[model samples]
Target: MSWTCHLDETDVQEYVGRVLGTGYTVADVTKMHGGAQKVVYKIHCRNGFACVLYVWDLTKNYFQEEIANERVHERSFGGHSFETNNRWLRNHGISTPALYDLHTGQDRYPFDYALVECIEGQKAEAYFKDPDQRVRDEVLERIGSMIERMHANHRQGYGKPDQSGNPRERCHLVQLENAKEQLSYIVLHNGSIRKNHDRLLAVLHELESRIDSRKRYGFIHGELGPDHVLVTDRLEPYLIDIEGAQFFDIEHEHTFLELRFGKHYRYFQQNGLDPNRMLFYRLHHYISLTSGGLKLLHRGFPDQVFASNLADYHARNTLRFMEEWQLDN
Candidate 1:
């Protein structure tokens, strides 16, 4: 039920005029699309200016999942916050976008624009699909190093939470709760597919129990995939499209990375990552995928190969992760 929007130059000029007074004008408006929840617009102002606009969907009848303004606001908080956190990440050497102006009060302007520095890079998906093995390895190494830096920055509190109710913790609670609620809709919403409902229910219980054991884990991207990663022409890696950023159970993020690059770990090690942590994350990544908790995301996955392999991998790792990590053991 979502649609793409392309804003004209006139639209941008007016928006900038409204926000920054009569003298200023919009140089250009570019659409940089990636996030599923919201549309992003990159902007350039008349006087050597640049920024981005994060638009949320509020035109729907039913506000479900990440659709509602409530949830959308929760995910992004605001263009201002995203700008601040992103700049903070960059300051800590995370290679994120540079903040300019956030669209916090952009209602006067139809298409919101947050001024930002544009990143020059290729998407991470191209790294794996690139035919040259050496190039792929180099790209993967840069990717791993970038993610490590991000985690290091996060641990240093670039995106950590404080009790305005601990944004990280609150975000995690929301994602888990949202996932549980979605599971209930299997019978109500999906198109006539039913099997082992009870088993699925049990899996949910197990996931909850595991997450509860470490309710105070830390911040997570909430949503992680190849698309979230950007590789610059200079071979720098950056994280973008944080529209679904949140604090979630650590293992979920681990699963996300493993699912995408698990088989390439042999190369990952040559890049100087700890094998045990990588293995742990990879195994739990399997747990994160096949676990009933992932049914909500699998709809967009193509073919049975991905889901079936995920399921088989999850079964194999269920005992391993639980026993080794003693998660709800």
Candidate 2:
């Protein structure tokens, strides 16, 4: 679970030279700021051209069983799927970084890497931080429109995309089971939640029934939020870290957007989403995040204090989701 920089300056320069012709030299490679799990390096080219390079983080803190499955499926061993998803979205008129080159690490680089056109813009989180309400609202509107368009590209099943741009049906059960497992982990670790285990399990069972019986599925950014959106000076929003995206209930996505932004934001006003299922998925997402942090805590990866704070924050949010569900009832 300890991820360190595997590629050095020389490796990057050589890779850039190979990708961009002999004259294009890498002047600098600086780590870019983002919440993504991959190591992102902004490579400055001599001719004023810049590109972003991402190396897969192999040392992810996953459960032992999860790691075994990942190895069997060869997940994160290369950037082919990442390129595929990016190209699929770009073909559908979504604004995303153009892929320049992808190396699976079997050829040259020591790790799987992707070189893509660098986008010049501030992350949407910065806009949210702005004191001006007008700026925030404007950005919110743009984000909402983008989300709608992304949802327009749908598939038959629920999960990650396959070669045919359809959801990988094999991942559907795994995704649901994983959610249930995370909820169980949360209940087992927290004393307060343990007392209400029966109630929580009943709610989860109901939510699972609702989700499993649904046939509607749409392409969605699984982790859509301000942090994942980059807004240019012209206010154009570009999405990043789309590897986790999949075909799922669009209403689930809507709930995520509302939670990240505000439920009263103009975006939610534009559409009517099933509030009950939305809140159910909201708790699922919240618990998954909190559980991931707890796993990190168990592995001694992130600083214990930071991990504790993160788990606390998400736990509070999860409780709020439960309260909202009760109120609706």
Candidate 3:
């Protein structure tokens, strides 16, 4: 059974004092929601200072399984990944939260933690609900451009930010194998997935044959969604939750954009993308999400409703996409 590790008053007080120096007393620590892999707290200081604290602990991670070798492209749940990715983005002229201090040792806390600059803004997801169309359009344009900039930064190799040199295998084949593993996991855990397992596998195999080999790769946010973007009062957008940022097939990033951005994805859409890669990546994304959601549910993630809904939504989409693909073919 999994459980969330929350820091007590003393824990927060000492950490804050050490990081922020003297005269910074903790007024309150609000546990932020929507994070499944790590514990995040918005720390408000008695002296009107505010910052965010991130704790990476096994107890906080909802997924219980060991990290698979094929999943090295996307890494998270550690201070090292966060710190490295933060510096990489900043060096590349991308906007990310400034790191105030980072503690990787186990002396202070059993888990790694970091103090970061708290971005004072609403998530780009919130802007979608605005009554003004122009407001929505402008935000979309800025975010779309920011992503384009990130994608334009090319790399010879594909992997996590800290990984150097080329990968041993092609990106698509690696993810295809990972997709099969995810589908198998989903089938075992979800009754709904079990019922349609064969059909899903058939669709995946059909898509696999259409994929073509590619050499060049681009830097991508790995999981760029409006929710991962924070828009300041001045309308500037900053990418957050950036540990997964890496160089990879741009198609993988676009596949996620289409899923997360939904109708607004058109603003960020670009030409010259390979159609075959897009279709293959789309199926893989659905299977991956379904498996991840089920893993969270089985391991007793804190938000039961979110976990259940995530699994159901993606599992249904997997079946729906299969049926749609079959009909089109």
> Each candidate's lDDT (Cα)?
0.52, 0.70, 0.83
Ranking by TM-score: 3, 2, 1
lDDT of 1 by residue, 1-329 (tens): 12234445565566567766677666666666633345676666678756666564333111234334353235453454465457556665766666555665545554344645567678878777778887887877877776554444233212333213343432334544544454355434232213434444455455444432222443556555677777887767777765445433444465566666657634333343333334434443443444442453454533356555655555555445545544443
lDDT of 2 by residue, 53-152 (tens): 8876555423444544652222423476577678778988989898989888556554578889888999887886678888877887888788888887
* TM-score (C-alpha, index-matched) for candidate 1: 0.64
TM-score of each: 0.64, 0.84, 0.91
User: What is the C-alpha lDDT profile of model 3 across 1-329, one tens digit per residue?
Assistant: 12223666777788789877979998877778647667788888889999998888766677535443425556655788889889988998889999988888878568888899999999998988889999999999999988898899876778776788365546777777878889889888788778988888888888988877666788888888888999998888999988777888899999999999999999899999999889989989989998888888888887788888988899888888888999999
Instruction: List all candidate RMSDs to the true structure.
Output: 7.0, 4.0, 3.2
Q: For candidate 1, give the lDDT of residue 142.
A: 75
Candidate 3, residue 207: how far the Cα is off, in Å: 1.8
- Name the candidate, 2 or 3, with the larger lDDT value: 3
Best prediction by lDDT: 3
lDDT, model 2, position 50: 89
Model 1 spans with C-alpha error above 4 angstroms = 1-11, 14-30, 42-53, 60-74, 110-112, 153-176, 189-193, 210-212, 246-248, 265-329
Better of 1 and 3 by TM-score: 3
